[model samples]
Target: MKVSSCLFNSLLLSAGVGLLAPLAQAGEASEEVKPAPLELDTAFVTATGGATDLKDAPASVSVITREEIERQPVYDLNTLLRRVPGVTGGFGPVGEQSKIKLRGLDDKYTLILVDGKRVGSSADLSYRRDLARQDLNWISPNMIERIEIVRGPMSSLYGSDAMGGVINIITRKVSRTWTGSASTHITVPKDSDRGQTTQYSANASGPLTESLGLRLGANVTRRAADEVEARRDAQGDFMYDDGAGGSKNQSVNALLDWQINEEQSLSFEAVHGVERSWASKKTFGDWGDTIGVSFGPSRLTRDSYILSHTGDWSFGTTKLDAYLNKYRNDLDMGKANSEEKIVEGSLNLPFELLVDQRLTLGGQWKREELTNTNTLGTVPVDYQGTPVSGSTLKGDYSAAFIEDELFLLDNLSLTLGNRFDHSDKYGNHNSPRAYVVYHPHPDWTVRGGVSKGFRAPSLKEGSAGAATESGGRGCGSLRPLGYLTGSCWMAGNPNLMPETSTNKEIGLSFDHDGWEAGLTYFHTDFTDKIEYGPLGQYQGRWWTMLENVDKARTRGWEGTARVPLGDSVTWRTNATYMLESRNLSTGEDLISSPKLSAFSALDWQINDRLSTELSAQHVGKQRGLGNDFVQSYTTYDLTANLALTKWLTLNGGVQNLMDKDLRDGSTNFYVPGRAFFAGATTYF
Candidate 1:
């Protein structure tokens, strides 16, 4: 796809207005006194592997501050991400089944991290594949210091699973003085039968000794399931379709940081979380007739242990990290589990040869194991042609990367990086990236980058022993093949290639006296996309298998603005407009991704003790399976906060204030109606 002149002209016009409006206001404020130089936030660390200014970061980055997290109630990460540009949720009943998407790509393409450590997804081990939600909410919101979202490919530094983008959640650090807070919140929907939620959380951080500090946090949440009207089946039995699912979540995390010396530090951390989810679903026959109903709870648990060390030497800085993660899911059929062990290290050196530069070197080793009874137990054999008896699928990979940032001129900088990865199953691959940042004026910045990234096939997608069965309607083919009268099998293939993409992005922004605005354009050429389809007939049963036979392209524009309405109020907004997102072979739109989405919020500090916020989200029409398209909709929320005393705070809100009905006839997506919530926090 090509960029049109009309779209380019519009962007130029919008950016010109945004850049001039702030300067015009500043010119009229003062003539004798000049404003201070523009200073941007520099605590962002995800995009560049270390603390870097948001304006200087080579990639498109955004940060969610702790203040934003506290302004309104949020239990899950997806709800919070709705405010960010270039993000969307997978199509499914709300809850454990919905996944997070970036840049019109699937959830598996995005990487989730905690304090620079990986958080493995449960879907990788389950037979349902990408249908499961990512394990993103393991850490309570109260324990988070900030979240960094980097859009576009990042494989040059982070390796695989970063082809789409990366989200890094930074947790609170240990404080010198002992401090703690406890809070509880309850939300009730207009409909009494469903959508009720309750949560309790607490956190504390303090000094444990002269050189050591400790931090701990825990939370519990439970939500009642949404009730869907039942229907009578052919056999006169009551059956239920998909509805918003209910979930119970509990988590605890602890960290101990030791100041080995003024120049060095050591840290150890542990996190454990459990989730139970239940939903009523109807089973269908080959002819799309309701056959039976299934209702039960599935349990998922995760545990992580991490050890890290950092040293600041006279010449440079060095860091090392090692972590172990385990995830397990228990269902009626059986239990599926996975484990990951990783060791990583990095070194930074600042020196001058021909020009001033900073160099970074890093390497990582990872091993993964998965045991799924649901997919592996169907047959009496294994992938290695060995008899099945407690057999487990395992894979390992190693990677090395290098990056250099060069100060070419007083107002210009360039960054070049490359990464080499060797996988046990897919052999070797290389990713490279180049970026440049320029400052024409102190208040204006221009940045652009182009990079290549790849996503290796998951263990479940590469295991020949893994298989799933569905009725005729679920079968896939390369051509116009007639539907089968019986069930067919979709098996995994061991000889699939990795998916790759070339990502390019350019952005321009202006900032002055807290008036900020920016615009970015991004495009990606994706090839060798892995998908499931028919691979001819096998033993007369008909078969579908994973293959690399698809190509796609995605392009879009993103814009953001923040303006102070007055001394007591502020308005913020961000929006995304899609130019193209299509599967080249079939010329169809990507599923569940909106063409135009936007979020806006207004915050008012009425007084020293009271504050309120009004927010709205608009999602544009989206294409679905075949020729179907989901209609567009908008929702609004209102929330307020009151500081009762020095040690007490109260908060409440009305979500979906407009009472928008998100249901369309199909059960692909769901969102609850108007709801009220209240909470209180006590500090010590």
Candidate 2:
């Protein structure tokens, strides 16, 4: 199989060279082939942010285009994010609550930005699990023009929650002409007992004038009921049967842009979404409906709005930019809910000191708030007769940061940055970072950086309530023996410290002829890591707390190559390898991190009218907190697209074509197997 794969790759490269040879020769004869358009090779951002070629950026960054998203048949952001190296998606009971992790870091460390603005749930909540932030499912991938991921701390530029890195989601903007499109998809599950999913989406955008533009879009999705197999006990034996569940969700968004002259611009956007789910298990108690289990339905509704304005001015030879953003999110969950509001602003000045030399300075500020309530019903009484009730909590945070970039030469650059944050709950923290990039030749570029990042304690870590045990008097109790033996957990700590880390990284990129590839390595040493543990004498129940553990490091490498197979075909392949471990004072390997994983894909353009794709992914085995574990698995997917006409196109795909049953290590949830989907899109 390895030999065959190599041979196929060679053939593709040869065919690509052969196809491009004639074009190159013709261009040389007529002087038609000039340097590639700057826009095609560089990434563009708003005036307030720095813009440079992807290769010129002094960070490990990746950009996924709209065409790539379509080719991969991704239904949402989570699925598309899987393609990014050193990133992982967690599975949850409800699909809407899923979270993403980068470089083996938790979700709280990664900041998610939309159109360069922070827009999501606040971390000031009593339930850590419920503070997973924005639901990517609500954001329509169809409206995305491009996505840029910076794989390291950016708090100096973006402010809080940027410890692991930042993901900038750039939406499509109205250009010169008006255009609209619509698409629908129907997905069927491998299990005959499970129901199917149907998704529909539409978008339109246009310029009202040369300086004004508007865009509107919406998406709706319904997933059929699916069963989660029984969970395994300590001995890896199946326990009680977990029934099936289903979900329905819909969202809409609108955006307006006014280019007020050439140096100033203003934009406004609003989004609203609602999700509903029905499951067979109770959230907090033990009850029975069919097999003596209570069946309850869950519903979530969210409304969000953002307004931003930016200005640019030229002072002598220096370019100055300033911007402000206001964001709000309101969420309603059947029993409880929360509201979050944030105001942020920033200013940046970049100037060139001499030939091949440049400098940049920037600063930013942000404020956030979160309010939550616990609506879980009363706990059941045991033989010992214990009672518990739900509660509510609220929190707020504020932060500021500054950064600078200096270019020593055409081939070398250095960056230094710092951030300071003050939280009502976690007090204050200061973080600093430094970066360097060197290019020895036209085809080789090397980069290295080190930074100190931190995450403030969440509201959940300060004031969340605890649950009591029944002294082992109930046979169906889920609590441990120690808990049932007379121990009960208390509330959280009011003086918890922030989680801090020293992150270090090095990377290299090469692009020559028809080949391009990149490799990056990173290590993070964490202090005051937060974990769910017993607080002092509170033996049984778990409390969200912090500890100063030893070094925890995640090292990874990613490589990708794209070779055109003749004029109408291209073969692109990428692979990722990651090794994550922790050196405790006791020297023990950390559990739950997937030691090795990989994904690959091949694209074949049969003709201008049709194309086919095949991809495969592999996940390694993982050890849990105790003796329990998860096994390794591999899955395959196939897809095809046919252009029925210039205005109409058909697309279909089958995921898990091998029908493999798999479960994630982080959330311990089962993934659907052998799902098939078909859709048709129309362009006008």
Candidate 3:
């Protein structure tokens, strides 16, 4: 099905953002000193192989600096995402199923990383391919110094899951003096069983000794399960019992930086994160003439651990960086349990020389293994949640890569890169990318790039395991209000080929004064997409199988504008418009991804001691899961900061200030209502 007219929404969004453009034109008030220059030329690492200015980066990128993070009242990744353009955050049918979508793509396509290291995938391994409801809850906001989001394919620099984009979180730096801060915040909802959510965090960074530096941090969050408010089925024919959303998570990270010599240095880091959440679904059952409703729990437990060492050495014009990391994760979902372990090591040497050019050579090796248990946990919460029975899956790969940057002219630069990887599961594959940047004027930069990206088949997708789920709404055998048992099966496809895509994009940006604006258009053509079979009947029962199928095309346009109206007032806005997203094979539209999304933030610095911000997010309508349409909506939020003293500060905010009713048509995700929060922070 074709979605709403993109032209109309694009115009509407552009008009809304256009208002902020004139704010930059507001005449400079007498005696109002010129604001500092915008950070358009700020250095970032994730978009490029190394540090580069934002305007020099090959792909589209956005950054949330520490100052911005501190100003917002966000406590979790999901909430933090809403502050960015094209990303959406809200409730799901089951509170635990809520997620963040990037450019109309779900979390599965968007990879998550901390300090340039990949995190474990939250997609269920055994069966159903269901994603973790809280994909970003494990990250500690207090530990982050900045977050860099790169849009479009980046599989050449990173690997896998970069099909949509990459979110790289950079942690804080250590200081010479003993320093730390503590803060706590709570949110009170207007209504719904979800109740209240609270969070606490503490962090310290300083010198442990003359030659040693250390940073320690910890965070804990608790979200009371929201009680289901509606009982009627979509058809309003029968009553069903559903589940609640109760989540609790805690994490800690430590880092030790040591100085061996002026030319060489080494660091050791460790991170431990854990999360526990529960989700439930109520389905109607009919025994002969009588109709009944039954509910079951889908409990999940996830823990992640990382230990690594990083070393850097410089000899004259040559530099070398080496890293060794061990990553491990464990998951327990109802009757299914899985554990994954990965060991990866790499070396990056940029000592090679070419024809008036610099060449960077890199080599990496990685080993990964997954173990799936057939039985449920000691106490099974859902009988049907068992998947993969019992099996061990393993994959190994090694690769070598090189990137060369050549200056064709004083104002033009060209970059070319390629990597060859051999995988035990999918044999050998190669990825290549080319990018160029031209500066016609000091304040203007033009860039365009194209590349091939791929996502290797996971061990679970190649094993003999399968996940089994047996309940769904609106089964053909039953009416809209009645429940019919329909089972979902996604057995492994050992012969599956790695999913690959051809990604291309180009853009231009203007950065001058205290204002910056940019527009980028991207298109990705994907082949051999790994997807599940349509819901159908097998052996007199309903089921679906995992298979590599379909060709998809996703193309979109993104625009961002930022202007510091004055020292006291600033305006920022970002708008995203997806021209098209569809599955070519079946000719079906990608329904769950919104076609238009936008975010606008207005900041007021009343004084050094007082500041306030108003943020608004708009999400266009789209087809919800098994639905024709979900309505579009807008949300307005207000937040403020008050400095009580030199080292003490207070914060308060109202989320959903308008209290506009919200319900996602795709998954019956209903908003809990307006919320109020207050918090305090102190530093030593």
Candidate 4:
């Protein structure tokens, strides 16, 4: 099957591998057992810039706690998040290239954070390729405390890149006492030709002195390439390219905290990470004949330094942060580097108006610099009769925001917020949001919100000197253009406009003695969608340019439920149903997005030392590259954990119990047939 550019192809071809993690042992038996409470009361920090009950957060939120993480057999962040409502993963040939989508929006619209700080996007620096490895797996699961996921537009508080939502990973805190853990996980597919994966991790946190503390963590992971010998399909196309590629990754982080006084603290942190990926594919001619075979390898390294301070006064809490981050991408042909520096601060003040009110004020300043190999040369000058030359580009932005949380009634609360941002490149933009939360009954909660969000053009997308080759692949149009055949040029448009969206949602949830259920309906109107397409030709050469020429509408319903069957058994499920996800300008449906997706799991506690879980994931029919539909499929997994001793635990599982590979369909994504995994953890 023919596809568009490499980026488009990579976006369509993702893996649905089921990686498992071990769970905690069952609790002791008790007579007249009462069902446990759901996540309604969990402390959530991402939704409102401060800690609040999950049920009270203004936005649709989900939390994955440490206990939940320990009980599952998940090794990667994508696998851990695929079960959440309105969340999906699309990975490239390299399984580690996890591209997450929230509410039918791609990675570019979803803001990723570590401890509520942006992790700067490396994917924005490249064109026609997927370099978004920085999004997921940057931190080891062993060092994580919990994850907070807020879905829908959040620009009113977070500014840009939050049109779809935000995902904040909260790491474990430094303990007063010495504590640490070491773990190893391995996955081996039933088909030897497929890839095999393994990972090792360790973490330690403790007090260094009466007024100081330290925390450290490290992890390493490696995977072998599938179909290393390179296989071809009946049409003489390289099937090996469809197989999961190989990857190697490493990460280390350290943090030190000093208590300045009873009401103040200072902290410093450093993190370093590396990612390597390699694969091979065959070149094809216009006549569908093999031309040559080539191997591609790339590396990415990131380093970050952060200094922060927090102070608690009589009426408010103050926080300040200064951070610097650096990234380098080394491709087989060229190299690119980027640096980001940011200074941000926020204050939360509580007071009594007629009722009660909590006011939050924040401001931020950020600068980004990018230098790449491809932009080092001058433009051809044939297109516009003028040559453009640039090797480095820099951009800066400043933003300020204010929010007020008011309790007007005994059971009702309202939140109003707005943010203003000014950038040298994009001028001035404003985002506004309003939300309400009400407790109709003691066991029920009703919430709704409306928000506006936007995304400014990246440096690589707005620079006339920036250019990328399509590698002879056609544009979005199916029928090939003569001038677009064989190494077409895709240039940047400095006049491009920003993408914007208006989002609305309402949700109702009920939680009573572990019998929990929730349903949320959301709608989004996305305008000025940026796309790379034909501009104008000169000297018989076609030049594609990024332009704001499209609009899209996405509406969906997300539902979640939890039930306690007995004292030792529980069942949980979540599902998403898309009502519409269409590009209004092109009249084409969003590709690779399932209309209905659901995940369910059943957990049983057999004894004090053992626990078992049976899980299933269902992906409904989805639009394909052409006017076709990829059939729906479901995968099952069974995992069990055993506590060998007080400090040692062992677990094993079988993924894809049915081995229902979609090879019969036209789906380009890879689905590993069947896999088995085993793991062990040691705690002190």
**Residues 1-684, model 1: lDDT tens digits:** 122455435434432332233333433432222112112333888877556788888998888887788776667777777688898773223532256778788778889999888998788555566446676889888888788999999999999999989999988778778887888877667544345778899998888899999999999988766655543434554434435567788999999999999999999999999988776333333335332222223788999999999999999999999999999888678768899999999999998988888899999999999888777646554433444444368899999999998988878989999999999789999999999999999899999999998999888788787776655545746245655467766777789988999999999999999899999999999999987776655555556778888999999999999999999899999998989988876688887788998999999876555678899988888875445566788889887776556676777777788988655454344566776677777777
Give one digit per residue, the lDDT tens place, for model 3 in 10-94.
Answer: 4334323322422443463423232221223247878655566777777777888777777655557666665576565444324
Residues 1-684 of candidate 4 have per-residue lDDT tens digits of 222344332222211111222223234452322212222325888888567888889999999887667664455687777779998664333422246789888778999888888888677445444434545677878888888899999998899999999999988878777888888877777765676778899998888999899999999988766553334545656553455557787899999999899999999999999877765323333434332221223678889999999999998999999999888878556668889899999999999989898899999999999888764333565245567666788999999999999988878999999999999888999999999999999899999989999998888878877777666553444234445245656777788888999999999999999899999999999999988767656555567777899899999999999999999899999999999988889888776678998999998876656677899988788775457676788899887766556677676777788887765425545567777677777877
Cα RMSD of all models vs. native, in order, equals 9.7, 8.5, 8.7, 6.6
Q: Poorest 10 consecutive residues of model 1 by lDDT? A: 30-39
Per TM-score, the best of the predicted structures is 4
Please identify model 3 stretches exceeding 4 Å from their true place. 1-42, 86-97, 125-127, 231-234, 237-244, 279-356, 374-389, 473-485, 534-542, 663-667
List the candidates' TM-scores in order: 0.88, 0.80, 0.83, 0.90
Error of 4 at 522 (Å): 0.2
Cα distance off (Å), candidate 4, residue 53: 0.5
**Top lDDT prediction, candidate number:** 1
Off by over 4 Å in 1: 1-42, 90-97, 230-242, 281-297, 380-391, 471-473, 476-479, 625-627, 664-668
| Two-way TM-score contest, 3 vs 4, winner | 4
Candidate 2, residues 1-684: lDDT per residue as tens digits?
012444434433432332333333433323222211112323644211367666667667778787667654455576667667776554322322145667767667788777776656433322234323344566676778788887767665655677788887887766457877888776666555455677888988888988988989998987655443345545654443333466677889888888887788787777887766655331212333332121112456667777777677774122222222222223243234555566656566666666333334444444433334432222232112344344445566666666556778878877776777776666777777788878899888898888877776654455433232222222122243233344333334445577777778888878877667777778777777655443433232422223343456666676666677677666666565665555454354555455665667777765555567888766566554344456767778887766556676667767788887544323343456676666667776
TM-score of 1: 0.88
Deviation (Å) of 167 in candidate 1: 0.4
Candidate 4 segments exceeding 4 Å error: 1-42, 90-98, 125-131, 228-240, 280-297, 375-378, 474-484, 626-628
For each candidate, the alpha-carbon lDDT, in order, equals 0.78, 0.59, 0.63, 0.76
Structure candidate 4, residue pairs in collision: 20-73, 20-74, 21-72, 21-73, 21-74, 23-71
In the predicted model 2, the residue pairs found to clash are 288-292, 288-293, 289-293
